[model samples]
Target: MNIGKTLFAQVMEFVPWKTFGRIIERHQGDAGVRTLGCADVFRVLAFAQLTWRESLRDIEACLAANQTKLFHMGIKAVPARSTLADALTQRDWRIYHALAQRLIARARALYAQEPSDLGLDATVYALDSTTIDLCLSLFDWAPFRSTKAAIKLHTLLDLRGAIPAFIHISDGKLHDVNVLDVLPVEAGAFYVMDRGYVDFARLYALHQAGAFFITRAKKGMDARRVYSAATDRSTGVICDQSIRFNGFYASRDYPEHLRRIRFKDPESGRTLIFLTNNTSLPALTIAALYKSRWQVELFFKWIKQHLRIKRFLGTSENAVKTQIWCAIATYVLIAIIKQELHLDASLYTCLQILSVSVFEKTQLSCALQPDRTQPELVSIANQLNLFEI
Candidate 1:
């Protein structure tokens, strides 16, 4: 961040605009138009997300009121509600998706060395999805039920630093299990999911890829125990066994042996059955990995509460995806800032400060800190003054 720039402009300085330009060129996002180019559209939508603007009209009115600061935010001009709406519908959503992924790569690297509670050295991820309800009449493209419509955000989150590594948006009719088919399998990584993704064939695929998985077993599963391993009862682990599927499909899909662990929670006294293929890790550690999957649920709740993905600005599919990806981009950008600046404030606090002080001409990093004392500015010969005397 530098002097003589709006806080919003300073916040956006972390983005790699040169890479963004290449992505725009590859996708032809700026083709045949000049007013709201790809970058400008992203900036305006990001502005809406950061400022909590609900509609295109609200964004238009706000930008109109703050006309002089639009240039600082990389918006060439104030777009009418209609133009912004059309731009949202017209621009390729993949452009924004690619940009979000680019930011994810950087964020993952920044948090790679983050410590894990499980004390495992291998990378671990949690998979889950959350549904957002919509109106059937307005969003006819996404048909969910007879009276209403909905969409799902299938996410794979890196537990380290709670960064989303992958996101897929689909209609509500899609089953949770289907997301596994398109998931990028990484060797030596551990994926923690729930029973909804317990297709034997798919789990076998992960096993063959040299990756590990921890998932809850369905009640009354059709598997026969081949061998039982020793377990310490005081640790809550009731039994650890090597099992083989008895059903025809399960047997055919996975001919190899599987490890199953039954553990009882001390407080609830309820037992849980967990299935996995990795035999090297301790049974308690595997159970703890399953327990950590709740982090993904917390992540979904966090984004839904803080971001603008719930009420959409456009009804078209492209428009919906655009809004979602921009929200994700804003999220990763904030995470990057938090890590780089070493700020003590929580994300919620940082967002609250940024939301109100976006256009404030002050030191952004200092203002976002938990301690908000103003810092003295030093003159820089290369920097031009906002107003020359």
Candidate 2:
């Protein structure tokens, strides 16, 4: 199947085009006649993200230069900059959102076997959000400050393979803690977070839904230690205790005892207090799970550096959302490819290879994977290790 096919074409084989077509139909993405439909726009935007195209003109120029390979790449024709911009502005962004959700489901199934590295059997999720600043003039819809505008990406990251389980886009004014109101709670799963999301009311909501949470407790939180649990001091776990809120409002909000872990980081020598509803796991594992929340932070940093979300191809709310969804779909797609192909190469390497070799008429495996029949060059002991976790 890889014979005589471009790497880009083969990479796209993972996409469920028929399903996306249904999504487009449901959204009526092509209700009106146009030079560029929603699907075409997605392909172009995905291509731009993969190839690191800086602007609309850059995308148009690149496609124009490779005009002959358009069909093979699934693009019927090269789109003019104006036409593409119009599509981005008019087409429903929900089409791409649905597509991205489908890709996420498929990717999650493929990566279900991945370990969380916590050595715990329960499902662990890292909850966080990152803000992307925008110019107030260009993005009047998203208001961050008196003069600045921005958008926030609220993400729930499944630590296994770092696949995003849930994503919500909102104006920068939206508080991170507010995301808990819309967060889908799965029973018995562990949700880790920082103190910014430490609202006792929302935490109780999660508790009521039969979900567990591990988050840093805010300073000056009034709580009475009801029972002190035994702990090993050498593991950096200072003390593990069962605590109940001492404040009237806090007690009313969470009318239940919570497990509290006090840990001192041997490396940083910083004492930390962690709050969680899960009482089964060891205090060390709880601390380690909190430490793993950094993966979501790294996930944010990685996509911002590699994807096109930092810069806007269009100014409309719909356009920006569509672009971000497509970028998410692209990231999930590449993650799917990496798993299916079983390539030892990192994602950064895979993207680097595809950036320049997308149009080449070669087998995807041969192009992405090193030749087994030939002698291979030795990899250095220390390489450019980027985002391995």
Candidate 3:
């Protein structure tokens, strides 16, 4: 409950910063002026997450003032703006990519547990993407932002744990369906996707892998019934339907795998169409499962609002990728802390706590050695009237 216990500090202690430093050293591979080590670069990235500082100068200034605190966090010295900027601009992005993948894999290992016994026939994952607008004049080559600037962050989120399992970044012009091949999918896992990702070939690939999926049929697609629908007594929703696609049904080889789930929208008094390969479950159950995909949208909202990710400090493609990945890394750290604390706080609330407890203090001593404990945190929460415990 002592949320003031610098979440970033606590979580960073767990990450192998030294190993990352070694990675950077190795990447340098018999180089010149030494430059900044990986720890220093990570410090800057971590600082960006702890505070929404957008520029290298701001980070340098903050670190310079809090040198002792930075030292505690494993930063040897505050690198100059020029140095940090050059390091970011020149450093091989593949190193960062490898580092990120390693971090995610480690987190998954730390948090993995037996699948929840929800008695559901399948586990569900959701897929979606959000646009991170950039400066068109600055990052000119970025795709889909010919008039304006933007990048797409496509993610596959595990619905049960509200955790992102896989993430990919592409130019703004990239279609959601095109990124499907890059994501990791398990055989029994169910994927719920928005209309933007409706591609017959990709869906068929998932079907071929023995995975299940539910998606809204595009408006113009034709549907032919294979079985009469049974009505649900409580919700008045249709129970089941066998359907044939207007086009060559990609999954035609697996005829028994296709089913239609129909439900009336409570708000509009209109019927919603959902196509799925899962036939063992009832129609309403499929609808309910697909409905959970909205959680990914909420996750996007949380990141955009809480992480201050709308603005970009770097102009080039690499800089944009670095900033976005750092933001995600930050989010993962916060989520890990929330799990460690056994607190049911929302991500924004947790970030707010971290911002106040870590970044607001001018001195590292004040920030790290705050005389706050679980009781004090509870009291502060009560005084601040934060009911999101």
Q: What is the lDDT for 174 in model 3?
A: 85
lDDT, candidate 2, residue 29?
85
Q: Which RMSD does model 2 reach against the true structure?
A: 7.0
Per-residue lDDT over 352-377 for candidate 2, one digit per residue giving the tens place of the 0 to 100 score: 88888889888776677865576779
Clash count (model 1, backbone only): 0
TM-score of each: 0.94, 0.94, 0.83
Model with the higher TM-score, candidate 1 or 3: 1
Provide the RMSD of all predictions against the true structure, rounded to 1 decimal: 8.1, 7.0, 6.9
Better of 1 and 3 by lDDT: 1
> Least lDDT summed over 10 consecutive residues: which range in candidate 3?
359-368
Model 1 regions lying over 4 Å from their true place: 372-389
Worst 10 residues of 2 by lDDT: 365-374
Error of 3 at 222 (Å): 2.1
Model 2 pairs in collision: none
- Residues 220-319 of candidate 1 have per-residue lDDT tens digits of 7999999999999999999999999999999999999999999998878999999999999999999889989999999999999999999999999999
